[model samples]
Target: MKVLTETWWSAAIGREKTVTVVLPPSYSPVGGPFPVLYLLHGFGGNRNTWLQCANLSAVVDSHRLVLVLPESGRAWFINDARGRRYEDYLVHEVVDHVDAAFNTVPTRDGRAVGGFSMGGAAALYQALLHGDRFSVVASNGGAFEAPLREGDPYEALRGDRNLAIPSTRDHERVWGPAGSEVRRRYDPYSLIRNRDPRHPIEVYLDIGLDDYPRMISMNRRTRDALTAGSVPHEYRERPGGHDWDFVDAGLRDLFAFTQGHLLSA
Candidate 1:
């Protein structure tokens, strides 16, 4: 596999962004167009997280596809009140750049999105919201649960917040304080329920058996929501914790699932 670093301008977020791309050994412009899989990184991670930790290149090498790993920082791939338009950049800017710069099948059927942890959630969330742009999604240990809930007003969090919570400040900054309208719009349950049955978005979600109780519960709730909503998806519970180990496990199979769907492109 061949890996390349790219730095480009993104007006959506009003800043430049760096992306990591991987190409299979047989990749070449002359080889014809190939499908592309876009990968997002979790909170606190940059563009290289999946490549370094998940062995993404090796796992998906045989698939003969293009892998695009774009950095999301702590933004959760959403447009926050702080003016960070990561979601917009991912759906438009990043994808546009890849398709123009690489030998890729530039269509909905040619695209797939996957991520780990916070990114996993972002992957599925973005795919659900923009099904016309992405046809398949694979989330490994995705943080599907919303950080804030209804009735939990953002104004109420002005004083004394719990520091023990994981990235509590970021959650508030990105998703906003509880009861934020964006949260409801981005809510997994609501997104799953709102999906049009006539157009199906293939989904693959998995969480470690040893993940935090909250993580496991949220993933279960999401899986149940998919089942109840009649959204086509594959769910799995594997042995591992919420680390790179868990993300790496069964990754090949997930890639295979992605490959199967990409064939139509």
Candidate 2:
């Protein structure tokens, strides 16, 4: 596998952005094309977080797919009603740029998205709002339901003026007076709450049984909602916590589930 780092200024975010790309082992000139997986990281993480923490390239290389990890700071993959058109950035800017530049199969059936923690929410938000563009999505301990608390950590970060994050908080910086309709639009649980999930997308989520007390209730609520909505999904809880060990082990199952679906598709 080959890893590359690149940057481009995003008009949607009104600033430059960075991303890490992992090329498959069979990325040769004669190879026809490869599917793409857009991976995302949680709050307070950057493009390199997945490669550094998850070892994703090593795990998925056998499939010979391209992985793109974009750095959106802590935007939560939503266009803030106050500012910053982030939803456009991911669906339009980043996806367009990557598809045009790489030998990727640019279609809904050939694409997938997944993320950890805050990133998990972002992945689900992107796939849910743009289900026609992604065939599958996975959320690992992601805050799928607006976090069930007012002023989430991202909101608290928005409140602090002097503390500058590394990648740049476009949502907070661009959308002053954060937490509004924009945030709600990206809430996965809200999208699935009362809606019919006959949508053409498959979803999966998992949280460590020992991670948080709320996880059990949250998963149960989400599963019930999906069941009622007729949304096809897979939900599970295993022994572990919020640490990387749990996430890494869970990823094996995630990749396996996704692989099965992709093949059957």
Candidate 3:
């Protein structure tokens, strides 16, 4: 596999952004375009998270797919009410820049998106909102439910039983003050409920049984919502937790599902 770290100016955010791209082993300028998969990192994670935590090199090499990891910081991959247009930056600027700079299949049928935790929520929201841009979407240990209460914003960052160290304050910046209309607009549950049934994108949802209780509950609720909407999807619960091990294992299945839809399309 070939790895390239690149930066470009994003008009949406009015700043330069960085991204890491992984090309298949057989990639060549003359090899024609290949399908693309955008793998988003979770809260407090950077573009290198996937390469560091998952066996993505092997997966990309085996599948001959191009992978992209974009830096979203704690933006939650959404256009914040506070004036940050991360969602626009990602969908309009990043995607367009990648297609222009690389040998990628520049169509919805050849593109897929997946992520873990916060990133997973972003992936699903983006796919659902812009079905014309993504053919398949997958989530692992996604925090799908909104923080309805004022105190729930810090719950995940605090970790189970308040064991994990917390550093940044993201909730208000991304989703607006808790329980606000802005927050509800970006909530995955709300988005799913309001999704257009006719423009269904192929969905994959997986969460660890041992993951944080909140995460598991959110994923379950997301699955139930999809079922109620009669949206076709693959949902699974396995023995694991919200960690690299769980993400690595889930990625294998995600890649397989993505390949089936992206390559065959």
lDDT of 3 by residue, 13-40 (tens): 8888899998878776665688888988
lDDT of 1 at 141: 85
Model 3: lowest-lDDT 10 consecutive positions? 162-171
The TM-scores, one per candidate, come to 0.90, 0.82, 0.90
Clashing pairs for predicted structure model 2, backbone only: none
122-156 per-residue lDDT for model 1 (tens digits): 88888888887898999988888754443333343
User: Each candidate's lDDT (Cα)?
Assistant: 0.80, 0.70, 0.78
lDDT of 2 by residue, 1-265 (tens): 7888767889998888877888878775355767777888776678887776565666777665678888767665667645667678888888888878788777777788888876777787788788767788887876665533443343434555633222223434433333555645655567776343444778888888876565456667777876776778999888886556667877677776666555221
What are the RMSD figures for all models against the true structure? 4.1, 4.7, 2.6
Between candidates 1 and 3, name the one with more favorable lDDT. Answer: 1
Clashes per candidate, residues 3 or more apart or on different chains: 0, 0, 0
Which ranges in model 3 have alpha carbons more than 4 Å from their true place?
147-149, 153-169, 263-265
